[model samples]
Target: MAYTLYYWPLPFRGIFIELLLAEAGQPFEKKSPSSIYPDHRFDRPLPGMAPPYLVEKGGLQIAQMPAIATHLAERHGLMPSGAEARAAATKAILDANDVLEEISQNGGVQMWEEESWGEFRAERLATWMRIFEETYQHHGGPFMLGEEITLADIAALGLWAPMIHALPPLEEDLKRHAPQVSALLGRLAQRPGLEAFLTAQRARDGQGYCGGEIEASLREVLGLKAEG
Candidate 1:
């Protein structure tokens, strides 16, 4: 059965699924809600009107990032085989997803008002990335979770790619504190399959979905005023 991804044309949460597919070297059909008018803005695509949904075996549709990620990981043998490792991978992936949700909601930028909520969000992001760096340092061998690349590593990269673009400070943080992560991210992007995906995406849409280009998008989305 061919895998089918139902998502918006934009990266959003859908990139995680794309990463999994690319890593597994699986061929799947990409469906954008926008391409279909009845899809209604082509935005959300869940039973409860959520998105990042997937269909397998032709008709089984699943929603939510974690759900879809786990489903794909298990199906494609991307997850660890050991019970403890599997649990850890799942937990780490879900934690990364939680951070992605929080950061993405803030319009993927540092342009939000510096109020209590914004401060809290920024702090949370800092804490999450720090923890992630440490965790990767501990569990990741050549890759997060082991010498082999697992769903955990893919999830981490998927979440970090956009967040780092949105928060430029993250690049500096990665260099200073998480050089491992920075290196891993660079390696992931340069992987033959992943690089093809990145290049194809850039060719198809000039808008940067990777970390480097998201900064400008953030400025645009937040409508930042020019500095004197």
Candidate 2:
């Protein structure tokens, strides 16, 4: 199946869809937002504000990360069979999306202040970590939904791995508060296709998380050198 993904140059939300395609061994083309927005934005197959838009081989288009993820997961056999399981997987995907929004401070709407960032790291962030950790523990898993890996596992990986990769200090927080979640990330990283994709992604992007002044503020708070 031929697929085209439209997103920003940075990984951010698009990485989830990319990882899913990679894990499924599906080949896809990526188009940048620059190529789509303000020109074909409203007239595109699926009209949407902002990107992470997905267009299929047959000219079907989908917008929003979770919706695109669900479509791909269903098509690629990444979603589970049972209704409850599917619902759970969907919940996981949404949860991952929520985490992304939280970390990005609602799509980088406001810069992260040190005090606020500290509070988030200590409280809100820790709560999210525990939520994942507890969910993993409850399922008794090497994966999020237990024995078999699903899009949920991939979601977890997409959410945390890039954050930890871009901000190394947060790795310790994840390891401390959510060891199983950390372990799950380790297992997902070991997948040959996913690992290769991640390597190439790192080469291409290089620790650039949600770009702009908000990201600059994040780096400052973390004492990280601004991306060069």
Candidate 3:
């Protein structure tokens, strides 16, 4: 199947969907930034406000990171069978979206100041991370949903890694406060295809977070040369 992904050159939000594709061992073509539809075109509302849309070979178009990842998971076996498990996994994807918004308050237009960073670290950040961690634990897994990798694991790990990169101070505490989450990252990093995707993306200089050129968190994890 030919999968075409349209996003800014950066990995930010689009990475999660890409992670699902890579983990499924699927090959896809990433559209270049210059070729992506003008952002202003999507600036109206709803589906019009984002990049990272996907076009499948069958002519189905999907937009939004969570939507795209979940859809792909269904077809590629990244999401497991059974209604409860599927619903739970999709809920986890939404949780990751909430986590993304919490960290990226302005949608990556700016970086965090000291006071704002403190507020995030103190309350919302830990709360969001725990939501994911508890879900992982409840599912009883080496992967989310237990025994098999699913959209939840891919989405959560995708959120965790780059966000951790953009905020270096959290690294030490993240491991301290949520060891399983850290352990999960370690495990996911070992997956050959994902590791390669991350490595290749990070190697690109100036690959911004949402194209803002400010996300500094991925270097340690992705070996990113992009400016912080």
Indicate which candidate wins on TM-score.
2
Error of 1 at 111 (Å): 7.9
Residue pair clashes in candidate 1: 33-42
* Candidate 1 lDDT tens digits, 21-127: 98889877778644433454344335434556677765566677788898889988888999988998898778877875565444445433446345644577567
**lDDT (10s digit) by residue, model 3, range 174-226:** 67666787788889878998888777776862334544433443232334465
- Backbone clashes under 3 angstroms, per model: 1, 0, 3
> What does candidate 2's lDDT look like per residue over 25-50, in tens digits?
99888888777776777777667777
Supply candidate 1's per-residue lDDT for 220. Answer: 46
Worst 10 residues of 1 by lDDT: 206-215
TM-score, one value per model: 0.78, 0.96, 0.83
List residue ranges in candidate 1 displaced over 4 A: 34-46, 106-111, 115-122, 165-169, 208-217, 220-228
Q: What lDDT does candidate 1 reach at residue 167?
A: 49
Q: Poorest 10 consecutive residues of model 2 by lDDT?
A: 38-47
On TM-score, who's better, 2 or 3?
2
Alpha-carbon local distance difference test for all models:
0.69, 0.88, 0.73
- The TM-score measured for candidate 2 stands at 0.96
